[model samples]
Target: MAKSKNFLLLISLLAFFPLCFSSKTIGGYLYPQFYDHSCPKAQEIVKSIVAKAVAKEARMAASLLRLHFHDCFVKGCDASVLLDGSGSIITEKISNPNRNSARGFEVLDEIKDALEKECPHTVSCADILTLAARHSTVLTGGPSWEVPLGRRDSRGASLSGSNNDIPAPNNTFETILTKFKRQGLNIVDLVALSGSHTIGNARCTSFRQRLYNQTGNGRPDYTIDQSFAAQLRRRCPRSGGDQNLFFLDFVSPTKFDNSYFKNLLAYKGLLNSDQVLLTKNQQAMELVKQYAENQELFFVQFAKSMIKMGNISPLTGSRGEIRKNCRKINS
Candidate 1:
């Protein structure tokens, strides 16, 4: 009788322990598990993908992971950034400075190839993004924490979802702030992540307001460098469309570091929103100073931000569908 009671108690504990088991079966499929630590294989695959892409030149597939977290955290990581008009992939036009992870399928292919070969289809693309971000951030001198693996991929993607959730480069600080806040991120994290924008470019469409709308746009006043603005004005010529996405931090387009914050302090911030850090959120400004001073501090916080962004209300346990074609998964 004693032995049976002990066995029953063990079973009860397993059944009731939500933290231990709940994460095991995320959204019912089972993922976000720790299959690999500092996954060397995963890093290699990320390197190969970054190596081949001109769009992602000097970039990391891990950025795609960051993007996946960005999008998903906003409203679930659907790989929406990877979607096309039809919800598949915009294979022709992918990953710009703003849409860093736009290399969607290409990066996914690389990670998938490696995982499939070494470990088979044991890991999902969803988790791939999760881990890749963690890995890449570490390489870029950010945090190197262990992410729970086993996050299953959503078989869905579409232009609408991408257009809907992802924050644009030139949106008002209020808009983007709300978006970040919705994900449980504070202003400091928002400023740091937006600082990533300091490294990327914006379409004429994304930045038109700054150039034309100007004052009271609610953007961080004079966010981009004046030289950059002049150059944009010359190229775009107020006619629009020609103002392509360029690197805000021309130094190292792909790496994540304090250069963004450094640029902002120098009035070299890219988007109006990027510039907004100074006046719109002074606390965020101080953090920029801190991150600029210490690399480890940035990494630790960035990882936590990434994690907060990843485990959002995913379409797990039947809440959302596994998108077949990321672009048109819903329609």
Candidate 2:
């Protein structure tokens, strides 16, 4: 009679929370419903904070989206990018690609604080990043997709991975492709992901080399439209103002769209890495043209590629800990 009562209780609980109890698994794969029961409001909390942050600063959406990319590239979206230097753990923030480029840490902290009040340590910081990126994209009129959860925070960071794995704005097309391949991504993924440039700003220092002495011949890169080059020069210059900001996509800087690929076609792409898709390789150029010509196609592939990128070597099944503070590993 006692066994029958216990079995009845279990069935009633499962009936009331069908998704919550069954979503989290022990294996490596993640699911969108991982936090359905564990923290039912996890996704909502992240999206609300991201939306509020983006509303305060239109560029916050892009910055938050880029944060996920940066985190994934180094140490597999384990929130390694969030860790500050402590003991043996060297922070990735000071690395080359992240030195002056990465932003949106404060916004993440705000989200983390809110989540802690609601669900405590049930949600992981890495999952918050992935969810924030998706919400940021949607807030900026980009495609929305289900972000798989279950990623845990890393106990240590990789400064070397940040420097070597994330491609620089001036890297050669072959080098950039090699970096993506290292992440198990292909050319299509690379081109689709680069479309993220459609919505952000780039520092003058990141692309100043293309405006002057691109090939060490003391001449500007001929591939860049001369008028655009002149505009960039007025702000970038040769010596000072290395930190001057330029819109990556001047047409719709805050909107997510195919104008970046179109800019590449017009030789007005802000980064050498952006323009090389057109000039350096046939396959890459074809992909760029397709995306530029078809916004729906680009959006579809971008959503798919984002899921692929987010799935790269995530920590699951007790591999890592849920960080209490994003910037510091648990003591």
Candidate 3:
């Protein structure tokens, strides 16, 4: 009788262990059903607002998704990127990577305003950003993943982290992979997440070096298809048009798919970072080719990588506050 009781107790403990630590497996103190009782309509509200925004402007999907990536890379998705500069807050928005580039703040504000009215200080801006990113992906015909919630907003922003952590368009393959690895992400995650470029736009300034004077030799990067480079040069120019918008994946600019990988296969990738996946590393090149040929494989890895990225050192439990307004911390 004692042995049977002990066995039953052990089984009960085993069953309860997963329920207790399942969230910990992905992210500390975060779970998909976090707002199930606190705010039953949290996900619904975010989805509806994001849908409306993307419908109004298709590019908004990528912008919103980029916001989450930028936020997570800096300060571990604490919504520091959303904070405005005021007093002690340096504001990640003004960092080198974000200035004149990062957008979709208004769309996040719209979601926050609706969420605030519905549940007061229930949802964190960090969580809002995560949900918006997932919705943006689905809206743009990309893979869908259940976002783990319960992240809280930080009272401070890291300007240096924003500028230094987020991978630059011109970063070498090793540098970019190093940055990703610093956040507990691997080469597979780096390649999969780079796929996000499939639906976004890059400014001419980002790839101008590749078009002219690559390696300071005053010659265009030969890796880029010469004819394609000429077409880019026509609009990108040598001196001006720094902000001229070009689809990252010209093949299906607004659609989220493996065309970005396919572009790299043909050396038509818009940014050096995108092209380096094929040119700079053997492992990354193999992954790019695989993704280009089997989009379903790309989609699966992208979703998993995104979830892993979102888990990077989140401020959870009681460590951070639930800001009444995403733009400012609670006074």
How far off is residue 30 in model 1, in Å? 8.4
lDDT values of the candidates? 0.55, 0.87, 0.88
**Per-model TM-score on C-alpha atoms:** 0.70, 0.91, 0.92
TM-score computed on alpha carbons, candidate 2: 0.91
Instruction: Write the candidate numbers in order of decreasing lDDT.
Output: 3, 2, 1
Candidate 3 wrongly placed segments (more than 4 Å): 1-28, 217-219
Q: Which stretches of candidate 2 lie over 4 Å from their true place?
A: 1-26, 217-219
**Residues 13-124, model 2: lDDT tens digits:** 3322432234444555677778999899999999988999999999999898888999999979899998888888888999999998789999999999999999888898
What's the lDDT for candidate 1? 0.55
lDDT of 3 by residue, 1-331 (tens): 5564354335434433443365453335777889999999999999999999999999999999999999999879789999999997889999999999999999999999999999999999999999999999988988776677789889999999998999999888899999999998999999999999999898999999988866566665778998899999999998999999999999999999999999999999999999999999999999999999998778777877888888788888778899998999899
Candidate 2 lDDT for residue 114: 92
lDDT of 2 at 161: 98
- Among these predicted structures, which one has the highest TM-score? 3
lDDT of 2 at 124: 89
Best by lDDT: 3
lDDT of 3 at 8: 38
